[model samples]
Each structure stands twice: as C-alpha cells, then as structure tokens.
Target: MLVPLTRQKFNQLIPLIATGPQYKYYWGKFPDFLQRLLISVVIAAVYVLVRLFAMPGFGPILFVLGVIGAFYWLWGPVFWASMRNAKCRRYKYSGFFRGRVLDWWITDELIGKQETVDNKGDLVIVENREKRINLEVGDETGFTAQLRAPLRVEHKVIARGQKVEMLVMSNRPDLSKIEEITDIYIPSRDLWVSDYPYLRRDYFPEVSRRLRDRPSERPRRRRPPEEQKGRRVEEWE
Candidate 1:
C-alpha cells in the first residue's frame, strides 16, 4: 500500500533518513545464469565433503540429509533471490500505483565511529548516522515498506492525505521488503529537486567534500561579502 503524505511530513522525515556503506558482491558482474551455476557447483562440492568427513553417524546415519540441505539452499534461497531481483526489475522499471501511507516512523541505530587518515594524511574522526523507516501501507493496499540506507529521504514535506505512488509487480505481489522506499513514494526523486542527498555514509564525503585534518588556509578575519553567484556568500575568499 502506498499512502499520500503531505509535503510537511516529507520534510520532517529528512534528517531521519538512514544510510550505510556500499559493498560490492563478488559475483555482481556475472550474468544470472552463470552466477547460479557457479553457486550450485560450489554448494554441491562443499556439502559432499561435509557429508563424507564431518558428519559422524551419531544416531540415525546422516546419509542423504546433507545433500537434501544443499539442494534446498540452491533451489529455495538461491532461486528466491533470483526471483526477487526479477520482481524488483519489473516494479521499478515497469509501472506503479498511487496509494496513501497507512502509518510510518523512523528507526535509528548506531553504526559506530572511526578515525581515518584523509588525503592530507591527517587523522579525522567520522561518525555515521544510520536510520530507516518502518512504514506500513494501509487504507488503500496491504503492502508494507521497509528500507536500509545509504538511502535518500524525500525533502518535500509529506502530510496526511498526500498521494504517494508504489511500484507494483503483478507476477509477485509481495511488497514487504523489495521495493525502494524513496523511488516509489517520492515522485520528486525522478526530478532531483531535493538538495539533500540519499547516499552511502562512507561515500557522503565525496558528495559534500568535507575537509578534514590540516586545513588552515581558510582565513578567519573579518572580510566578507561578494555577490559572485547572484547572492552574498557567507564564507568568501
């Protein structure tokens, strides 16, 4: 279910948007069939070894049970992963439906802070704010929306009765944890009006370019006021 939020509510949820690090999957570049084939081979060999060596005939001889487990992993979990990707493709690139938000809230968790050397080799401390939205769609549909960030939130204020669009995959109508929250709910995302970014916290420095460690060139005197870009700049050279 997609609920329409008012513009005000949308803006309020900005700061609470969550984000995290981006990890590259080892087989990300491989085609789906190749990746599945590789996984099947690896899983088969690993289970065969475990069944031969590790399994001690404690009670009722573990003959083919491990083999069954391996097959289940390949067919059940692995197959579902492929189907989930397909569903996402259909809903994201295909069409979507407009619905109203049933209810929503922000959830925050600490990912810890770390000190790192920047380009200048100076030690800098970085703190990450990780958050997510637990929203349920009702009053229109029964789908639920959840997202883990490196996520961008809607800058437009969302209020009750505001119309929101949700991506729909007719083949697999499950929307519990597959759809992108921002892409489906915020129409402006397709427009890029929100100045605030939805990106990985680790890569955030690239977006805003934060200066850390050994930065004393910026003058701290009382010389300010240059209308270069049509407006008086606060920190000027």
Candidate 2:
C-alpha cells in the first residue's frame, strides 16, 4: 500500500520527533516538567557556584562553558530528533508494506563491565549486559532485511512467519519504488518495534487499510524461482 506524500500528512508526523520512545533512552522516563526542573536546578547551581569561587579571568570562561553545557543538556535530544525528522523529508512519498517474520532470536550483548572491591576486600568484575531481539523479515518483493532491537516483553511472542508491517519511503511522487524503510509495526500484537519510533502510529492502521482497499492495481513483478525458495537471501539496502 502506497500513497503520495502531502503537506498535511507530513506535518502530522512532526510530533513523533519529541514523543518517540527513543527520547526515553536519552533522558529516562521522567516527566517533562520534572526533567526540566532538574536541569534548571543543576544549571543554576553551576552558574552560582562558578561565579562565587572562580578567579576573575577563569570565572567568565567557566560561566560561558556552563551556559553552553546547560543549553546542550536541555535541548540536545530534541536537536538530534529534529535532524532525523528533517532527513526523512527527502522521501517525497511514504507507504506501508506487509512482510512475514522469517526468523527471530535473542542475543546477550555486553554493554560494559566495572571492576569493584567486594566487602571481603576481593576484586570483582561486574558486567552490564543487554538483551536484543534480531529478526529477519521478507516482503513480496523477495527482499529481506535483518532488524535488531532491544528486547521487550512483547517481543517474546514473535514467531517465524508472523505477519509484520513496515513503513517504506520513496522519493518518487507516485511511490512506485521504495527508497528506504524505517519502523516496523506488528498489527497482530498491536506493538511497534524499532530503535526509534519514526511513525505517527495513531494514523497508520487506517491509512494502511484504506490503501490496501483502494481499487488501483499494484505493479506486477516476477516471483522467485521455486528452487530458490530455500535459498532466498536478497536484502534491501
């Protein structure tokens, strides 16, 4: 299901920049007001303390640095999200496509390790690890892509051959071909899996359904050879 991009549809996605789950990774689950309060307190303290103790020449330099740091800590994540959102504008068209999960697995990733002294005065190495889910999905075009995401509770239910939906982007006005893909939405489970939430999902299901039900015919393409069924490995860039 494909559709030509419109100014209205484009503006609707703008909220995703700040509301995406990826923002939690940057600043945690704290509420917006609480986060801003904490940042303000810290910045005020830095400004006051630096001015009180630093020597004449050094005080101005430290104050300037403090202001810069404050601005970054307050707005850095938003700035990054804005850049990503701007980048998406290059795709003049967008659409949803269906695929089946061909395979899935979990892997333990070592994040970091810290060396510490135990109560017994013995040295201990504490390791930090994260679990990630890896999925390989294929669409009707015979193209497959490997998607990796931080494992969540909902992901445990994902299985081979389960239907999956993804957002595809195209530069062409007609949406004749895909230029890039981002964000995977699992309709069965009502779950979204992605490193970053790129779609305004509230509008996704309806849009996908409407397009699929439209009377226009999709362009035809040759199917993969029968012998290649077990060996199909074409990947989309």
Query: Top model by TM-score, which number?
Result: 2
Candidate 1 residue spans exceeding 4 A from truth: 1-87, 90-95, 111-127, 131-134, 139-141, 148-156, 170-182, 187-237
Report the C-alpha lDDT of model 2 over 1-237, residue by residue, as the tens digit. 233446466556535366555455455445654776677668878788878988888877787777766666566677667677778766666655677898888999997899999999999999989999988887666767777888999887888878887766766444445677777877788878877677777877766566557687553343335533555222211
- For model 2, the superposed segments whose C-alpha errors exceed 4 Å read 1-11, 14-16, 20-22, 29-77, 87-95, 120-123, 170-180, 216-237
Query: What lDDT tens digits, residue by residue, belong to model 1 across residues 1-237?
Result: 222222233323222323221112222234644665666667667766766666466323344654554455334433443443333333322122344555555667667788899999999999876765544443333444433333236633544444444333322122222334333343333322111132223332321222222243432221223322243222110
Model 2, residue 173: what's the lDDT?
A: 42
How many steric clashes between backbone atoms does each model show? 25, 0
Error of 1 at 157 (Å): 1.0
Candidate 2 versus the native: TM-score?
Answer: 0.64
TM-score of each prediction: 0.30, 0.64
Which 10-residue window of candidate 1 scores lowest in summed lDDT?
19-28
Q: Give per-model CA RMSD.
A: 21.7, 8.1
